[model samples]
Each structure stands twice: as structure tokens, then as C-alpha cells.
Target: MTTKRIIPCLDMTEGKVVKGIQFVSFRDAGDPVQLAKQYSDNEADELVFLDITATVKNRPILLNVVAKTAKEVNIPFSVGGGIRSVSDMQLILRAGADKVSVNTGAVTNPALITECANAFGSQCVVLSLDAKKVAPNRWNAFINGGTLDSGLSAVDWAKEAVRRGAGEILLTSIDMDGTKKGFNLELTRTVSRAVSVPVIASGGAGSMQDFADVFQTGEADAALAASLFHFGDLSIPELKRYLSEQNISIRRDV
Candidate 1:
């Protein structure tokens, strides 16, 4: 059985790691490089560094910050935000990102996904979807740090992203983010069922049971969280042990 992955996400803005509720009310977490090293040493399966402000500011991802963070950890890391073109993807991968995640950029120019996949292989291309519930039965896409609405349905956009050559989907529920309630299982299951590629569920991870629920109920390939890992409320090793005890397949440090 393939072990389900546990990933820690670092939301970076102006070079500092931060976290917030529903993608707002930001609070400083710590230095990106330092926090990343700690997570890596503590047995985090992977790390995601997001330049949260770059896209909102209409700027390129800060490579200097990525370089600094990458230097501190040995685990595979992914970088996203303000990544607009193939050249931008190249720069990030060269900076030590094993994968490059694109959200707003892919929405604006979907061909960018195909371009990066062709140049760097689909495995290196990740499509990060920021989605929010707009009505009882509808969820719309948001971009530029959840400040602008794309007016696209989550299901439709996810299918389009996969068709355009995304190897994986990093689906985050803007409604559930930082709520610590649990993952948006319906949304995750919807996307995972819609796409052939692996779907990673992010946002709203409050406890160990939430992780297990996401994998079992959401059918997510991986579960990613920020605050739960950031504040030491849940350590990766302990979380994995808990998952194993529950008989949920998970990668354990040998």
C-alpha cells in the first residue's frame, strides 16, 4: 500500500512565514528557513513554500527567499505564487524546488501548464486551486491571494487544469482554511474523482482524526496543513504513529 503523505505548508509573505484564518487576518509564524529546517528534521514528508503576497502584488516569486529556505532542508519542497510563465517555473526549479505550483497564473493562461509540463515534465507541475463556497451547491475559484474571484466553478476548473497537463492538484478550501474543523471532504472527493492525477487536500486541519478523515473519506492522496504543524500542536511523527494505529497507510521513518 502507498503510504499517505503528510505535508506542512509555509505561507510566506515578505520573507516571513505567516498563517491566518480563512486566508485573512494574518499572523507571523517564524522565519521561513528556520521553520523549514525544523520540520524537515522532525520528519515532515514534504514542504510547500508559498509566496502568498507575490501574486496579489503582481510580482514574481522572490527567488532569494526560496533559495534560503531550500538551503535549510533536505526534503522535497514546492514553491508557488506569482509564477506566470515557463521561465518563472525554470527559475524556481533551479532554485531547488522539486515541484512548482501554479494557481492564478494557470487560470490566466492555462497554456502555461502545458508548457511547463512539456519542458519540465508533468511530475514537476502542480496546480494549486483556491476554492470557496459561493452558494449552497456551488464553489467558485479565487486568485491573487483569494482577493479576486475567477467566476469559475471548482469542478470545471479542476477538470480543465488536468486536461492542460497538471500532474497533481493542490486543492485548498478557502472556506475551511484555518478553521481547524476538518477538511472539505465533499470538495476533495469531488476533485479527486474528477481528476486522474493525485489530489492533495489542504486547509482546515485541526486534529489527527481530521487527517485520517481526509485520507479515508476525502480520498485525498495527501493532507497538507499549516497552523497545526506551525504551533507544534501536532508533530508529524506523532501524527503518523496515530494514523498507523488507526490502520491508515502512512509513510513512517525507517
Candidate 2:
């Protein structure tokens, strides 16, 4: 069986890691390089650094931060936000990002997915979707840092992106972001069932049980959390040990 991954997310802005609720009211988390190295040492399966405001601000990703993080961390990480073309992905990859995540750019021009995948191979392309519940059992994908709705069904979009060559899906629930309630199981399961690619579930992770639920009930291939780890609420080693106790396969060598 493929071991489920536990990834720590670094939502960044102005070169500092930040976290917010429902994509607003941001608060400083810590230094990206410091957190990246800490998570790496803690045995996080992987890391994700997203420039939260890059798309809405129409700015490029913070390559200096990415490079600094690359130099400090041993595990692979993905970078996203403000990536509009193949060149953007190239620059991010060249800066030491193991994968490039595209959201707003893909929503605006889905061909960008095919282009990035072709340029760097599908494994290097991750489709990051910010989804909000529009109705019971239905969620809409949002773009522009979750300010605008893309009007695409989250599940359908995931399937389409995978068909276009996305190797993985980073599904974040905008409604549940920073709520610390739990993951959006319905949204995650739907997307995970629709796509063959690994689906990384984000938003609303409050406890270790939440992680187990996301993997077993939500059918997610991975679970990602930001504030839970950033604020000393939980450690990767503790979470991994808990997951192992639950018979959820995870890398536990930290």
C-alpha cells in the first residue's frame, strides 16, 4: 500500500509564513526557512509553500524565499501562486522547488496545466484548488486567492486537470481553512474518487483523529495542515505516531 503523506503547508506573503481564516485576516506564522527546516527535521513527508497573495496582487513568487528554504530543508517541497506560464514554473523549479503548483493560472487558462506538465513532466505539476462549499455536497473552485469563484465543480475540475496531466491535486477547502474543525470529507472524497492522481487534502485539521478521518473516510492520499503545526499545536512525529497506531501507513523515521 502507498503510505499516506503528512505535509506541512507554509502559506506565505511578503517573505513570511502566514495563516488566516477563510483566506482573510492573516497573521504572521514564522520565517519560511526556519519552518521548512524544522518540518524537514520533524519528518514531514513533504512541504508546500504558497504565496497567498501573489495571484491577487499580480506579483511573482518569492524566489529568494524558495531558494532559502531549499537550502535549509532536506525534503522536497512545492511552490505556488503567481505562476502564469511555463517560464514561471521553470523559474520556480530552477529555484529548487521540486514541484510547481498552479491555481489561478490554470483556472484562467487550463491549457497552462498541459503546458506545465509537458514542460516538466506531470510529476512536477500540482493543481492547487481553493474550493468553497456553495451548497450541500457541492463546492466551487475559487481563484485569485479565493476572492473569485471559478464556477467549476471542484470534483470535475480535479478530474479535468488530471486528464490534462496534473500528477497531483492540492485541494484546499476555503470555507474550512483555519477553522480547525476537520477536513471537508465530502469534497475530498468526491475529488479523490474522480481522479487517479494523489489528492492532498487541506484545511480544517484540528486533531490527530481528523487526520485519520481524512485518510480513511475522505479517501485522501495525503493530509496537509498549516496552523496546527505552525503554532505548536501538534508535531509531525506525534501525529505520525498517532496515525501509525491507527494502522494508517505513514513514514515514521523522524
Candidate 3:
């Protein structure tokens, strides 16, 4: 089996890293650059910086912050929010994001995904779907940071995104986000199994067993959480060690 990845997420707003529950009730976490460096120093597998309010604010990503944060970490970094066009992706890539994630933009004009993948290669395009359960065993994609429902099936969109050249899928469960109850295993497994590309499961990570359950049962390629890691609930090394003890393959070396 491939090593299960543990990714630390930084949800950005107004140039600072923030964490919110269910995509609301925002709280300050820390400076994005400092947090990025700390995670890198601790051997985090990867880091994701999301401009959570970018879409709602209708502004471009904070390139200055992205550039500064990229310099602090050597690991792969992905940036999202306010990314609407190929030029936007170019700027972000030039600024140092290893990958660019899009949701509303890609959904509005899926051609953006093809254009980005064509311009920067599929490995650079990550389609982030903010999904929420609407009916029995059914979930719809949300855009603009869980504010608007796209009415698209999470599973169907994931498949189409992959077909359109998205190399990865960042699946965030809006209902489960920041709940720490556990990952939406049903939602995660459905999307993961539907897409050929790796799916990073986000939201509802409460404990190490939660991580294990997502990896083993949810079939997620990578599991991402914020508050648990940002609040000192668990360190990356500590989590990795626990996962290793559970016989889950994981990267030990930074």
C-alpha cells in the first residue's frame, strides 16, 4: 500500500491563517508564513493554504502571502481561492504554489481546468469540492466557501474534473467541517473511489482514530484538518507515529 499522507491545512482570510467551524464562526490561527515553516520543520507531508474568503470578497489571491509562505516550506504547497483564469494560475505558480486549486471558477467554466492543466500540466490542477449532504446518501457541491450550492453531484463532478485533467481532488465536507466528530466517511469514500486521481479528505478530524478510519475505511489518499493541528491537539510527528503504530504506511523522513 502507498503511504497514507497527513496534510496540515491553513485556511486564510485577510492575510492571516484562520479556522472556522462548519465554514463559519471564524477564529484566528496564526500567520500563514510562520505556520507553514513550523509544519515544514515538523515533517508534514504537505501543506494547503486556502483563501477561504477570496471568492466571497471577489478579489484575487494574496500573492504576497503565497510567495512568503512558499519560501518557508520545502514541501509541496497548494494554493486556492480567487483563482479564476489561466493567468491567475500562472501568477500563483510563478509565486511558488506547486499546485493551484479551484472550485467556483472551475465549476463556472470547467474549461478553466483544461486550460490550466494544458498550460501547467495536470499535476498542477487541483479541483476542490465543498460538499454537503442534502438527502439520504446524497451530497451536492458548494461553491464560494460553502455559501452557494452548485447542485452538482459530488461524485459526478469529481469524475468529470478528473476527466478534464484535474490531478487531484480536495473534497471538503461542509457539514462535517470543523466538527471533529470524524470525516464524512461515506462522502469521502464515494468520491475517492469515483476519481482516479488522489482525493484529500478534509473536515471533521477529531482524533488519531479518526485519521485511521478515513484512511482505512474512507479510502482517502490524504486526510487534512486545521483546529486539531493548529490548537496543539496533535503534532504532525505525533500523528504520524500513531498511524505507523497502526500499521499504516507513512513517510517518516522530512
Candidate 4:
């Protein structure tokens, strides 16, 4: 069986890691590099660094921050936000990102996914989709830090993104983000089944059982969380040990 992955996300804004409730009421977490190093030491399977405001601000990703954080950890890391073109992706990868995640940029120019994948290989490109339940049966894609609704259904967009060459999908539920209630498993399963590439479920992870739930349902290839890991609510080593004991495949810390 494929071992489940536990990834900690550093939502970066103004050079610091921050967390918010349902994407608002932001509070400082800590230095991204310091937290990243800690996760690395604790055996996190992977790391994600998102420049949360770059896209809304119409600025490029903070490559210096990426470089510094990448230098602190040996594990593979993916960086996202304000990535608009193949050149933008090139700059990010050169700055030490193992993969570049595109959101608003890809929404505005779907072809950018193909361009980046063609130039850098699909394995190096990720499509990060911020989705919110707009109606009982519909989830609309949001962009620019979840401030603007793209009016696109999440399922349709995931399929299109994969068809356009995104190697993986990072689907986050805006409503569930930071709530820690649990992931929107329905959304994760829908998107995962809609696309062939690996799907990393994000938002609303509150406990180790939540992680197990996501994988057990086959709704996500990996579970990514922030507050639970950032606030000492959960430790990577302890979480992995618990998962292993539950017969869930995970990479245990050496």
C-alpha cells in the first residue's frame, strides 16, 4: 500500500508564517524557516510554503524566503502564490522549490499549467484550488486568497487542470480552513475521483484521526494541515507512530 503523507503548510505573509480562522482573523505563527526546520527534524513527509498574499497583491513569490526555508529542510517542498508564468515558475524552482503550485495564475491563464509542465515537467507543477461551498450541491473555485469567486466548479476545474498538465492537485476548502473540524471529505473524494493525479487534501484538519479518515476514504493522497502542527496540537513523530499503530502506512521517524 502507498504510505500516507503528512505535510505541514507554512502560510507566509510578510515573511512570517500565519494562520487564520476560515481564512480571516490572521495571527502570527512563527518564522517559516524555523518551523520548517523543526518539521524536518520531526520527520514530516513533505512541506508546503505558500505566499498567501502574493497573488492578491499582484507580486511575485518571495524567492528569498523560499530559499531560506528550503535551506533549512532536506525534504521536498512546494511553493505557491503569485506564480503567473513559466518564467515565474522557473524563478521559484531556481530559488529551491521542488515544485511550483499555481492558483489564480492558472485560473486566469489555463495554458500556463501546460507551459510550466512542458518547461519544467509535470512533476514540478501543482494546481492549488481554493474552493468554497456556494450552494448545497456546488463548490465554486476562489482565487486571490479566497477573496474573489472564480464562478467555476471545483470538480470541473480539477479535471481541466489535470488535462492541462498539472501533476497534482492541492484542494483546500475555504469554509473549513483553520476550523480544524475536519477536511471536507466529500469535496476531496469528488475531486480525487475527477482527476488522475495525486490529490493533497487541505484545510480543517483537527486530529490524527482526521488524517486517517482522509486517507481511509481514498479521498486524498496526502493530508496537509497548519494549525494542528504549528500550535503543538500534534507532532509529526507522534502522529506517524499513531498512524502506524492503527495499521495505516506512514514513514516513521528514524
Greater lDDT among 1 and 3 belongs to: 3
> To one decimal, what is the Cα RMSD in angstroms of model 3 from the true structure?
3.7
Clashing residue pairs, candidate 3? none
Residues 105-137, candidate 1: write the lDDT tens digits: 999998999999999999999999999999986
TM-score of 3: 0.93
Q: How many angstroms is residue 58 displaced in model 4 relative to the true structure, after the best TM-score fit?
A: 9.9
Model 3 CA deviation exceeding 4 Å by range: 20-29, 55-61
Q: List the candidate 4 regions with Cα displacement exceeding 4 Å.
A: 20-29, 55-61
Off by over 4 Å in 1: 20-29, 55-61
Q: In candidate 2, which residue pairs get closer than 3 Å at backbone N, Cα or C atoms, i.e. clash? A: none
Span of ten consecutive residues with least summed lDDT in model 1: 20-29
lDDT ranking from best candidate downward: 2, 3, 1, 4
Report lDDT (CA) for all predictions: 0.87, 0.88, 0.88, 0.86
Q: 1-254, model 4: which lDDT tens digit per residue?
A: 66788998988887777774132212323667777887898889899988877743433437777888778889999999888888888988988989999999999999999999999999999999999999996899999889999999999999999998999999999999978898988999989988999999999999888888888784689999988877777878888988888888888766
Candidate 4: lDDT of 208? 87
How many residue pairs clash (N, CA or C atoms closer than 3 angstroms) in each of the candidate models, in the order given? 0, 0, 0, 0
lDDT of 4 at 181: 90
TM-scores, in order shown?
0.91, 0.92, 0.93, 0.91
lDDT of 3 at 110: 93
